[model samples]
Target: MKGRNSIQFRIITGLLLILLLSVGVSIYLTTANQKSNLLDASQRTLAVNNEMLNTTIRNIMLSGEAPIANRTMEDFRKITGFLEFELYRTDGSTAFNDYDTLNFVNDYQSMVMFDQTPRVEGRSIDTEDFQQVLMNKTPVISLNEDTREMEYYFPILNFAECRVCHGDDEFIRGVSHFRISLDSIYDQVRRAGVLMAVYFVSVGVILFTWILLLMHRTIIKPVLDIGETVNIAATGNLDIQVDLDRNDEVGELAGRVNHMISGLRERRDLELQNKVIETRLEENRKYLDHIKEGLLLLNSERRITGQYSVFLTKLFMREDIAGLSLADFIYPDAERFADERRDLDGFLEMLFTNKTADMDMIMSINPLNEAVLQLDQDNEIIIRADFLRIVENGEMENVMVIFENLTDIVHSRHELEEERQRRESELEQIATVLKMGPKVFEGFIEEGERAFGSLRGNLTNFSDKEFISEAFRSVHSVKGTARYLDFPGVEEHCHQLENLFAEVRDGSRKVDKSLEETVAGTLDSLDDELVLIRKLIDRFKEFSVGSESTQVSPFNVFGERINDMVKDISNELDKDVVFNLETDLESVPGLPEIQPSIFHLIRNALDHGLEDIYERLAAGKPSESQLSLRFIHEDNWLKIEVEDDGRGLDMPALEKKGVEMGLLKPGVHLPSQIVNVLFRPGFSSRDEATSISGRGVGLDAVKEDIKKMGGRINIRTSRGKGTTFVLLVPWKGDEEGVLV
Candidate 1:
């Protein structure tokens, strides 16, 4: 029963309930209305009959024809099928009775004496309607439940004619009572109710049957089919499709179920594929672990994932590296490598987002390649990293990072290179000594000794600009010759001495006792190396009378030496400098004798006058700074001009430095006075001393040497533009003939 209480059952039950209620209410109303209408009709009929009977009795009594009135009353009862009819007097005596009329009035003697004889005693009427009719002299009708009949009463009144038979004082003479049986009317009403009940029952049965069939087809059957399909689906039978070809809610539900099953089927296949991939990945991971090289797998986020090789843990010096961001381990200091981190982030972003594009170019310049890892404060390692993109399902998923430690390899290579260079240098030094014949070697040795002797003499008397200038010139001349002879050890020592003079000349280092000692020590070292070279030359003296020497112009040799010095300085400072010799070598006078002074000026210009490449670029100049040497003869004087497109002298800075050095007061100095400060013995503009400058000796030396040659040195400069140094010396004959 509970199972049967479904939508269909509920619908049917409700319909039946409504049908029954409607039919019952309708039947009740019908039966009630029928009874009321029948009662009304019965009362109206009795009223009319009573009125006619009263008129008849009144006329008959007036005419003294008692027998006719009695016979009429009798006929009314028999024709109308009334149960009883009686006329009673006011005193409750029955004046006329239909039963008596039938019994006596039918005979002639009873009819003739009906009005004259004593009134037959009426039944004493004590009913309320009967008493009302008598007292009020009006007609009354009522139903008798016990008899199943309706009784009617009419009060008789005394009129002028009725007074003849009765008394004139009486308002109502008598009462007429009539009773009618209700069996026939009740029978009609019962038949009508039965017919209506039959009609309603028939209609309800037909409607219920039609509705049951409609509900089954439209709602119940479809629901049952959906339920059964769902049950099958619940049991994992995804192949069972709900094929309800409807455009209703049920149809939509079926369509959703079908879609769900399709998704499930796809998911099952994908799960199986995932398992296969996982197995393959595990196998690959195991293989990778055995390899000696460090290997790590990183996701697109640069986070470490999956199993990593044991070597990787050893390389990074961390064991619990899995599931952490690779950036955290590699670039541990965010503040230190913030820019690199951003770059790496962008690199990974491109690798992940632009999966289909080739990443070879990006990987080639990757910062991690051949990066130096500072494992700790004391221990550092060089590593080469290689990246391989990992793609899955046609999309980039992860990156495989392979790290190779190159620290040992690099160190060994460096040591090997140093050893090879040492051996090569030694052999070249021996070969240079052998290549020169005894005469040329002797001349080279004699010139080197003269240059050293002059430099040592100047250093001993290094109190004034002339002595410093002579010392610088001697050292520079020796350095040039050694370089020309391919004597690297001798040349290197001379170069170091030249740098010391350069620093003193640039006012970047002070010429104190310590400076003198350093210069003396360097000169001693050079002397030792020179002696060793002379000994080597003597050892190889018998091997060859040197080949005929090619004659080169003295100016050409001087220019070449200057060129080499500038090149060397340029290389040391990592700057690009172009040196131009804009002079007629034939016209230059006293070239060999004044070579030291010219060389000093050239070295000074290279070390101080030219700006570094980066500074030149920032100043909107060419990356390679320019230096030009112009030699001209005018008015019996050889004017040598050394000009450079460099950051010119800062006069104010020089003045401030002069003030700080107690060379000048804190007041403005004339431009000439500021220029003269360059000739001040230890006045330097540079703050820190370098091997090249900040020793305050080069320009002072130049000035003194030019003065000794009976000439003058002057400088002209413009801020941020360039500087020019002009040496005006007396023109002498170029007695050393040009060999070119």
Candidate 2:
């Protein structure tokens, strides 16, 4: 509900009220003027009639007692209003009341020679205002008391010329009174009032109609237009302008309203644009934060201007390090140190010149006394820092300083070393359980007895690979237990075992299976001999040592492995499977590692190569298939292409299934390049859960295996034809460059 504007409404209402009041005033004045005119016209006619009647009566009254003729005055009175012919005697007695039709006939109803009304019979004998008509004191006109109907009365006096009857001092006095009727005038006035009321009412109606027209144009129409504008504005439609007909106040007001609306639209647009800008700004800020690695902005003076991420703060531990020279974070006397680094410069020059050089430097980091702040739950304390700057990089302007926290690394190494030792001890304990029988070979001696006298004779030198490998699993157990039981030189014996195993495992030569078997038997006897000794070691808290070794020397090829696989794939296809084998890698260069994963992809290609066996028969083609394995090397990248004469994947059905599974849009166009989404993790279109294809880990695992080696695999399919999978890869793996 909309509330009315009290001030404006009141102003309009007040103006209407004033108009009503003005109309009322005009009607009142008009009614009054009309009433006055009616009254004046009636009064003037009455006065003229009175004067004519009085002149006629005076002639008769002064005619010396001549009989008063009523003819002339009767006519005058009828023409005006009412006339009464009531004569008064000279002695004030009633002579005659001749006009019987007059209701104003007074106490003197007698007909006589004298009458009165409006100064009739102008004899000074007996007038209402004449004092000389008195017999002795000269009486004046006699008073006539008729009903007050605007009547005029006068007295007729006897004249001295002839007094027909006796009269005092030859003066006969009488009176006549005439009356005028105003009923007609009052009727006219009432008729005028009714007409005036009608006129005023009609005028008021006309005024009201005019006001409605004006308001419709000025107020109502404009308000309707504004309402329409408001509706459009609400709907976010900013195109329309209110069209108006006039340039009055309402028009001006509408113009202002339109202007205000335009301003609001502009503001809304501005705010929306600002919101988009703000969102992009926040997004850019996050992106900047993502890649801003250990960056420190510096001014022209090489002073730290600013730093933005947690990495910098962790490295420096000094938020207040700003405004400081860049070299302040370096080793003490960095200025002098930098100057003396010309040797590093010379080595760098040698690097560019391809000349070998080994430049090493030692530097220390001074720690601020402030305690290290710990925030991440998985953080360790940092106490000191030292850097081993080795100049090997030739392109950079700055020294390639490699800072290492040797203390932390060394501590970690110790902990890991302890864990390894404990694991070895546990394995040794398990071996003891496996050799629990005390009656060993029916010729066992004392628990402290060696396999032969002085067991260390054959393993004197631990550095030899074959002897060490055999000694660790065999004699190492005997030695650890012997030490636990206090056998002489037992600790030295176990250390020799550790050194021996390290050499053998890390050696270049491979140990034969026969040697391994031979060592296993010796290990069993040694574990049994040391079983009781291990119990003693547990009581004394002693453990055997552990070590790690790795060797990546080339191993012998399984010789006929590639030929065997090719024969197998071709045999399965039941056709001559061609091998466009790159001669350089006819035998897989890194066959030992790749053979495990490669066989799966190769087998899958052959098994599913049946391209509508019947259709092939009809097309005069062999039911069997042809498969080709092509391998090439270019620019450190190995490209292997696997092709087969087999039915391609049912792409339409696959896409439909993908849609039905709600993983893809109904009309999405699957890319033909990688049409085989079957390579995706856990993907299989084979309907059956269990198949000779192996349960789980199909092409998915193949893809994963390739990916784990930082390689990529892609498949291209052609319907009714065959599919080809291309595997591009790196022969060298991460094992070389791995930080660990």
TM-score, predicted candidate 2 vs. hidden true structure = 0.27
Shift of residue 545 alpha carbon in model 1, Å: 4.0
- Highest TM-score scorer: 1
Every model's TM-score: 0.43, 0.27
Q: Flag regions of model 1 displaced more than 4 Å.
A: 1-289, 316-319, 331-342, 412-556, 564-600, 603-653, 656-664, 676-740
Q: Estimate, for each residue in 165-250, the C-alpha lDDT of model 2 and write its tens digit.
A: 33456444555555555566566666877787778778777876677678676687687778788788778787667787568887
Clashes in each model (backbone N, CA, C under 3 Å)?
15, 25
Q: lDDT (0-100) at residue 630 of candidate 1?
A: 91
TM-score of model 1 vs. true structure: 0.43
